[model samples]
Target: MRILFIGDIVGRSGRTALSSRLPGLITEWKLDLVVVNGENAAGGFGITEAIYNEFIDAGADAVTLGNHSWDQREALVFIERAPRLIRPLNYPAGTPGRGAAMIEAKNGARALVINAMARIFMDPLDDPFAAIDRELAACPLGEGADAIVVDFHGEATSEKQAMGCFCDGRASLVVGTHTHVPTADHRILPARTAFISDVGMTGDFDSVIGMNKDEPLNRFLRKIATSRFEPASGPATLCGLAVETDAKGLAGKVAPVRLGGGLEEARPGFWP
Candidate 1:
């Protein structure tokens, strides 16, 4: 299975880049499944129904969310209707949308996509480890799911790394999001799961974590916020992690993808 997991879409810039590039990449890379983190697709807040639909139209098999999953009030309602949209699995019992989903890839293979939020330096949600364990147990990788992708959205690197290790041999890929910066540690773990601390944001790198430079810089220097933080207007770099899984649903190859905008282009050399 050739799977691609895109990082967070910050705002319009990020969305534009995705809309323009994803389809071509899908064909060029012969991707079987594509998952995008779209929590910040709407003005760096949360994704809307339209934006979510846009992502699906642009070849996204599944769209994942983070702590900002509920930032857009409409999400609470629309999420129930969008089966391909997944929120954090560790949310309280009554959370609106599902934390994981089993969707068929373009190649007709079944893939289990799970989105879970970490507790470190963030909301005190349910234990992510236990939550994911139950999900994976219910659907063993090779038997029930041909491919399993875990999107661990969090602030701390340690927590994300731990999640990757926890799901090491079970999942096809375990990539982190939320910090908005790509980490260089993209590699297949000992157990065969593709792991990366963070895949970075698919937005302009000219700003502070995808936001306008002024507001964040002002807030930091003056310790006061006089203006609202907005997404940068420049071109965006579509950042993500690509993995090729074996018949047993374990990653055989993993690589980072950074394209367009200010970042240098990176694509797996093994792919034709």
Candidate 2:
């Protein structure tokens, strides 16, 4: 199975890039499964139901979230009805929406998508490793599901790497989010799971982590919030990770994806 995991999307810039590029990429790459991290899709805050549905309509099989999952007030109420929209797995017992989902890929195979938040310099939550272990045990690859994708959203690269190592042989792909800056460490682990510290954000990279640069600069210099942080409206670069799973549901070929905006364009060479 060819699975693509898109990183966090910020504001209108990110959404525009996704709307314009995802459908074509799906057809061009012959992708079987697509997962998107949409925690910051609304004004660089949280995702809304409309944005979630847009991602689904654009061919996303599962949409994941992070700390910003509740930035949109409506998300608290609408998440119950959005099956494919997954929040952080470790968010207490009664959090709205699910932390994992079993989805049917475009190729008609079962794919388990799990979203978990790391707790280093992040919101305190249940043990992510434990939560992930339980889910993986229940819907293991090559048995309960044909493929498994884990989106580990966190602030510390160390935590993300640890999670990747912990899930190495069991998951198809384990990619990081929240950093919004693409890293060059994407590779298949010893156990065959594809891993990356971060896949970056599908938003304009010219600014400070997809936000308007002025505000961040001001905060850094003045140490005070003069205005709200807004999403950079410039052309956005769609960023993601591409992984092809073998018969055993382990990752085979892995690559980075960056297109448009300021980043050098990239695509999975194997796909072409």
Candidate 3:
């Protein structure tokens, strides 16, 4: 199975890049499944119903979220209606949307996507390890699901790496998000799970983590909020990870994808 997992989408710049490039990627790469992290799609705050629909229209089989999942007020209500949208599985028991979802890929293969947030330097949530373990146990890879993908959204690299190691052989891919800066550590783990500390954000790299430079700069210098942090308007670089899974749902090949805008380009060699 060939799968692509895009990093966080921040506002218009990210959305534009994705809208323009995703269709072609779906064809050129012959991707069987696509998942996108869209928690920051709405002006770098939270996703709205429209943006959720937009991602789906752009070819995302499932959309994942992070701490910003509820920044947009409507998300609290709309998430219940959007089955393809997944929030952190470790969120409080009564949290609105689901933490994981089982969706059919383009080829009719089953893919289990689990989105879980880390607690280290992040909002305190339930144990992500246990939360994801329950899901993986319920649907064992190769037995119940053809593929398993885990989006470990967090700030600490250690936590993300730990999650990747924790889920090693159980999941097909374990990629990180929320950092908005792509790392060069995409590799298949000893247990055959594809791991990357962070896949980076799909927004402008010219600014600070996808936000306009001025405000974040000011906050860093004077320590005062003069204005709201807005999403950068410049062109964005779509960032993500591509994985090819074996018949047993273990990752056989993994590569980082960085295209367009400011960052240097990268493509999976196996695709061609």
The lDDT for every candidate, in the order shown, is: 0.96, 0.95, 0.96
Which segments of model 1 are wrong by more than 4 Å?
none
User: Model 3, 24: alpha-carbon shift in Å?
Assistant: 0.7
* Model 3 lDDT-worst window of ten: 92-101
Candidate 1 yields a Cα-based lDDT of: 0.96
- Cα lDDT tens digits, model 3, 1-272, are 99999999999999999999999999999999999999999999999999999999999999999999999999999999999999999998888989999999999999999999999999999999999999999999999999999999999999999999999999999999999999999999999999999999999999999999999999999999999999999999999999999999999999999999999999999998
* Native-to-model Cα distance after best TM-score fit, residue 139 in candidate 3, in Å: 0.9
Model 2 worst lDDT run, 10 consecutive residues: 88-97
lDDT of 1 by residue, 74-148 (tens): 999999999999999999999899999999999999999999999999999999999999999999999999999
Residue 262 lDDT, candidate 3, scale 0-100: 98
TM-score of each: 0.99, 0.99, 0.99
lDDT of 2 by residue, 1-272 (tens): 99999999999999999989999999999999999999999999999999999999999999999999998999999999999999999999988899999999999999999999999999899999999999999988999999999999999999999999999999999999999999999999999999999999999998999999999999999999999999999999999999999989999999999999999998999996
Clash pairs of candidate 2? none
Model 3, TM vs. native: 0.99
- TM-score, prediction 2: 0.99
For all predictions, the C-alpha RMSD in Å is 0.6, 0.6, 0.6
